[model samples]
Target: MADAPLRSLFQQRFGEAPDLPEILATNPEITRLAARGSCRHFTPDQIDPAILETLCAAALCAPSKSDLQQRDILIVTDPGLLRDLKSLLDAQEWIADAPAMVVFLANNRRQRQLQAWHAQPFPNDHLDAFFNASLDAGIALAFFMIAAEAAGLGCCPISTIRNHLKEVRGLLDLPDHVFPVAGMAVGHPLRAPEISARLPLAKTVHHNQFADITKEEVSAYDTRRLAGADGPGWSEAKAKMYASPQRMDFADVIREIGFKLD
Candidate 1:
């Protein structure tokens, strides 16, 4: 049976009783931890250096493609550099206050260097290499967030860092074939954030074939999300958010950084 906290978290997530698997019901602690929301507001306390290293180690433990280990984590500790990086993100002002910031890089250069060192031909220079590195970095980012949250730290992913890709690459002194995948801000939370509601399993999950989301499902999700909040529903909010083009020129940036999308 799920513990009280796990049950409560499930209720918050689905707006009803949870029908969890036996494994989850038996291990309620993991379920509770996984259910926590992303925290944006953080306190002034700095994350300890040792704990930060441990979190990075945990992140590195994530699976890599063919054990190529194409992901690199750059911990931003320099005050001036951090300030300059924060300036690039005017929309995410809270990043300026984050005690710890990390940049996750998709490093294809390392593998290429390794191939050259072994006198091996680097045949895969196209999109597959780029895709592998990006996917590896993304996996590492997720692991880092999981580890940080488990250690009682708050983490907020900053994908907007891509908007200033060239500036960030210059600031970080990243070479060609080493692209910034994402940034994360970590610190202790000032207050716990509410768990954001997710779509029902029936709407999201599929049996064997892919399923299309119906208008009724979107309407139901919107009603459920706007129960007490004052704003547009999920569909409307996302529509407004994407009404204007965002990061449309990122492809040019990627190509400039030596990634061949073709």
Candidate 2:
């Protein structure tokens, strides 16, 4: 839009910038999706149950580890329950505005139950089961987000579901081997989000072996990202925020959830 070289740079950095003719002729359904990113603000309009089911079906179509199919999705529609969940998850206010919320669970319990029902030994109760369940659930969540966005919905993932692990499980009445991996808030976006900058492909994409990124590469990215209002930019903001000692304590939470992931 500025100059040919700048347009080329835009294409290289992001995928492409639409021309005027393209914008007038093109259907934004797919074109807009290519520029997809997160939206934190959402409209309070309720999403239809039929559309939500379709999104869940699309999510279930995601690839699973060895086709074990251990992931489960739980939809939360009750306002009171949502309030409780919000309080448990550090009261992220955006969540309260979402008309639909989903909890993705890593469900190892079902397999163990099947093994027991079939009168099998079921002795493989080590770390792999837990890891596989979590991995599968995570993949499903990714698919769900993409599918929801394509369906004209916005989604934000809340990992703070891990913060009150026991309370979440108790509230959901979960079994022993099932774990709450992540929560997703879904609704119509109140406003479109600006595309966030990503590091150049050369920094991320490796030809054969893993390529190392240098300080120079990071500096270039910082400059590219900060050309916005109130941006000390992505890298600096992240660095300053995480520079302080942060306590994630994920291991302890997993252990309490009956995952002996040594």
Candidate 3:
């Protein structure tokens, strides 16, 4: 039987968990998928070509902005390239072990070509264009992760792709208008990753009126999360992490890569 907390998670996902009609009350598939979380420890089993193709297909099925399918996925099977990228990304050794790694890109170049071929002026040629492509890419990445999990696979998104943006751009031979939004490493799971604590839904959901946040709400979250097995957790950890603002100069790198986010 699904416990209250687990069932509440399903409910919180879509505004409220609906009671299943008598006939379809329990779905093994959804229950199984909902149980998933990230997986840091992975087995060495290789994913087959057919499955990889299916995963990519599912990813691309994600909604695109204005039907302008401006996203691409680069499947990296090359060991040498992976090692080089690892070195560039501060040598995070865990990255190199994953059997498959893929870079998801925001490809604005295609739209530019469409403009040229159709003899149209690519008028919105400033920051908005870049932002749109990046958003599109991010949506695709999210869909891909959810689809992969639903298919009984485990994944970890590596935003560290930005840490070595220049190197990755060169390695992938990405054109000027194509930027790496994120990378994903996939494999079979050895064990489930830690279930990181989350703030209660009440803390986040806003009703009809824009609710003002109170100190009590914040304190309540801190106390509730810190009380679990993953105790000693506090919002201060997040504050401290962001306080110094490490890895803050990526805009300069973005410009260097020919994106004029003016």
Candidates by lDDT, descending order: 1, 2, 3
Candidate 2: Cα lDDT at 125: 76
Cα RMSD for candidate 2? Answer: 4.5
How does each model score on lDDT? 0.87, 0.80, 0.76
Better of 1 and 3 by lDDT: 1
Error of 2 at 219 (Å): 1.4
Off by over 4 Å in 3: 1-33, 90-93, 228-234
Predicted structure with the largest lDDT when compared to the true one: 1
lDDT of 3 by residue, 81-166 (tens): 86676667655667656778778999989999999999999778889888888998899898888888877778888888887777
The list of candidate 1 runs beyond 4 A from truth reads 1-4, 16-18
Between candidates 2 and 3, the TM-score winner: 3
lDDT of 2 by residue, 90-205 (tens): 55777767788899999988888888899988777778988999999999999999999989899989887987777898888888888889999899999986677777767676
Candidate 2 Cα outliers beyond 4 Å, as residue runs: 1-33, 244-248
* Best of the candidates, TM-score: 1
Give TM per candidate: 0.94, 0.85, 0.85
Compared with the true structure, the alpha-carbon lDDT of candidate 2 equals 0.80
